[model samples]
Target: MRTDSGLRLEADPRPPRALPPVPSAIQGDTPLSRPKKKKPRTKNTLGSASSEGLAQAPVHRPSEGSELPAKEPAEHPEEAPIQRRQRKTRLPLELETSFTQKKASNSSLLRNENGIHVEPPEEAVTQKPRRKTKKTQPAEIQYANELGVEDEDIITDEQSSPEQQSIFTAPTGISQPVGKVFVEKSRRFQAADRSELIKTTENAEVFVDVKLSWTTRDVALTVHRAFRMIGLFSHGFLAGCAVWNIVFIYVLAGDQLSNLSNLLQQYKTLAYPFQSLLYLLLALSTVSTFDRIDFAKTSVAIRNFLALDPTALASFLYFTALTLSLSQQMTSDRIHLYTPSSVNGSLWAAGVEEQVLQPWIVVNLVVALLVGLSWLFLSYWPGMDLSEELMFSSDVEEYPEKDKGLKASS
Candidate 1:
C-alpha cells in the first residue's frame, strides 16, 4: 500500500467499509445513524442505513439469520424514503418485491446492499396457497390479511398485503388498497379494548344433546313444513289464540254478553296461564338447547343477533305489540272484573252491566292473545345462535380436510 514513495505502509484491517448508496428520494434528507438501529432485528424485518442529517432511511435487507419485524405501530425505520413514498402512495410493498424478485425463482441466491447473498423469503412468506375463509368479501379478506405479525391489532380500515390483496392484481391500474386511503368505516372492528382477549365459550369435549327427547328439527319440518320450528311454533300458537278470541268473543258474541263474557272468562283462565308459562319455557329451551352454545371471538351474540337485517325492526315490532297488550290493564284486571259478583251465598242477576261487556272483553282478548303472534312480523332473521352447531371433543380446531368433508356430509 505504498503511495508513490520509497517508504510503504500496510493498509488497516478495517478500512472504513463503504456505506450503501442512498435512494434519490432520501439523498437530501439527513439519516439517523443510531448505533442501536445498526443491530439487525432478531427475525424477519426491514434493515436500516446510516444517513448524514435527518433520519432518512435507505432500504437494506437483513442477513439470513435476520429477525422478523412488525409494521405500523411504528414505521419501518429501515425503509428507504423512496419505499416510504411508494408505500404511502397506497402501493403494496409485496407487489414491488414480487416483480423484482423473479431471479429468486430458481434459487435463494439473492444479493443485498452489502453484496452478501441471502435466502429470498418470497416462497416462504409471499407465494403460498391461499387459505379459504368463511367470508370471501374484499373488506373481510383485507382484515384477515392484517392478521400476520401485527394481527393482534385489527386496523378498523381495509388493508392490503401480500397475504391478501388478491393473488395477482392487473398489471395496469395498480389500484390495490394498502392501508392508505381509508374507506368510510362500516363498523367492522369496534374494540373497546384491543388488548382484551375474546370470551370463549365453554364447549364440551364430546358432542352431547341435552334436549334429545323434545324433538328433532326434522319433526318440526314434517308438521309445519318449516325447518326451524322454534320461532314458527312459539309465535303461531299465540297468533292462533288471538284470532280465535277475536272471531268468537269479539264478533260472534252478540246480545248474549253475559253468556259470552262467562264463556270468554272460562276460556281465558286456561289459555292465559298457558301462554305466559309457555313464553317463559319457550325462551328458556330455545336459548339453552337451540344452538351449540358457540360464539365467535369477535362476535357479540346479542349485537349480531339484533343486527341481522333491519336492525331492531323485528325486535321493535314484537316487543311493541307485547308492551301494548301487557299495558292494557286488561290482563291485570281480567281476574277481578270477570269474577262473579256473589255474596252470602246469594246471587243477583246482572242483565245489563254484565251483558254489555262485549266491547271491553273483546278488546282485552285481542291484545292479550295477539301478543304471541307479533314475532311473525320479524323477517330475514340471521342465525345468531351459533350454539346450534354441535361440537365434539374428537373434532379438533383447524379441522383437517377429511373432517370437513365428514361434517359437510353429516
Candidate 2:
C-alpha cells in the first residue's frame, strides 16, 4: 500500500499482528526464553548424537492429536501383555488366572478375615492352564503376591510337602484342629491364617482361665497342716501351765484335800492367763490360712479378723469372768475354813499351819493354768474369711436395665 505522501513513500502499512495466544501460565508480552540445548556428549559419539537430537525437541509442549510411532511392545505374549495391548484389553488374562487361583485356595480354608467365601469367575480357571506352572521367571514367583498372598508369607504348597511344613507335632494342649490335618485337609490352608493366631495369642496374653485346682477341702487341709506347727508350741505351754497350777494348788492346800475346792475357787483371778493361749492359737491359724490366699483378698480378711464383733468377744468374756468369780469364792471359803475360828487351827501349828500357806500358793497356780490355756487357744483358732464374696467376679460392671434406659433417653 502507498502512503498518501506523494514523495513516493510506501506507508508503513502493516497493522500489528495479533499477538500469538499466550498461555495463562506465561505472564506479560515478553517472550519466554527457550531452554538452552545441552551440548552433545563427546564420549560415545553415536549415543551422544542420538541423545542430542531427542533432547533438542521442544519440552513441556502440549500434546497434539498426532499418532505415536507403531512398534512391537513386548517379547512374550503368554505373560503380561505388551504395553500396547495392555491399554486396549480391559482385563488381562494373567491377572484373571491369578484371581481364579486365589479364589480356589481361599474356599478350602475353615475361616477367613472376610468371613464368607466369594466365588471367582468361571472364565478365570477355564482360560488359564490347569497344571501348575514351574516358577522359572521372577514375575511368576511373585504371582502369589498378586493373588492376595502377603509378601512376607508366600508359601507354596507345591514347594514343600505337608509333613515338612507341619508347625505342631504333639498338639497336647491345643483344643483346635491338628496342624498337619488342617494343612493337608483344609482348602484354605495356603491363604493367610496369621490373623486368627494373632487374635488368639492376644486374648491369651490378656486373660487366662486358671483352673480351680484345689477344692475347698484341700485348702482347709493345707490350712490345718500349717496350723499344726503353731499348735505344738501352744499345747506345750498349756501343759506347763497346767502342771504349775497343780503344784501351786497342792502346796496351797497345805497337804489337806479338805479345802481343795475352796483353794481352786480363790485362784479365779488367774483366768485371764488362758486368753494369751487362745490369742496365740488364733494368730497361728490365721497366718497359715491367709498366707495361701490371693494377695488381693488378703487385706479384707485381715480387716475382718481385726474388727471382730464386740458381741462375740463380750460373750466369751462373760463366761471367763463367771469362772473367775466362782474360783475366787471357793478360795474365800477355803480361807474361812482355815481361819483361826475354824477346825484346822488346832492341827496347823507345826507347818506354818496349812491354812496360812495354802491360799497364797493356790492363787499362783490358778493364774498359770489360765494363762497357758488362753495362749494355746489363741494360737490355734482359724480366722474369718471376709473376702470370699468380694472376689467372686473380676469382670467389668454390666449396665443395669435402669442405666440402659437412662442412656437411651439421653
Q: Choose the strongest candidate by TM-score.
A: 1
What would the per-residue lDDT of candidate 1 be over residues 1-410, giving only the tens digit for each residue? 11111000000111111112222222222222312332232111221111211121121122101211233213445554433332222112121123222232324212221224343343222111111111122332232222222211222223223333344432212233233322235755433321121111112211233445444554542443233455545555555555655555545345545355455455556545644654553443233222312333224445544675332334433444455444544443454344554434323234533544445565556554434333443333444334333332223354687787999999
- Summarize candidate 2's per-residue lDDT along 7-108 as a digit string, tens digits: 111111100111122122221111121111111211211222233323322220111102211121122224222222221121122222233233444442
Alpha-carbon lDDT of model 1 = 0.34
**Poorest 10 consecutive residues by lDDT, candidate 2:** 6-15
TM-score for predicted model 1 compared with the true structure: 0.27
lDDT of 2 at 107: 41
What candidate 1 gets wrong by more than 4 Å, as runs, is 1-232, 255-260, 271-311, 328-339, 342-375, 379-410
Per-candidate Cα lDDT values, in order, are: 0.34, 0.34
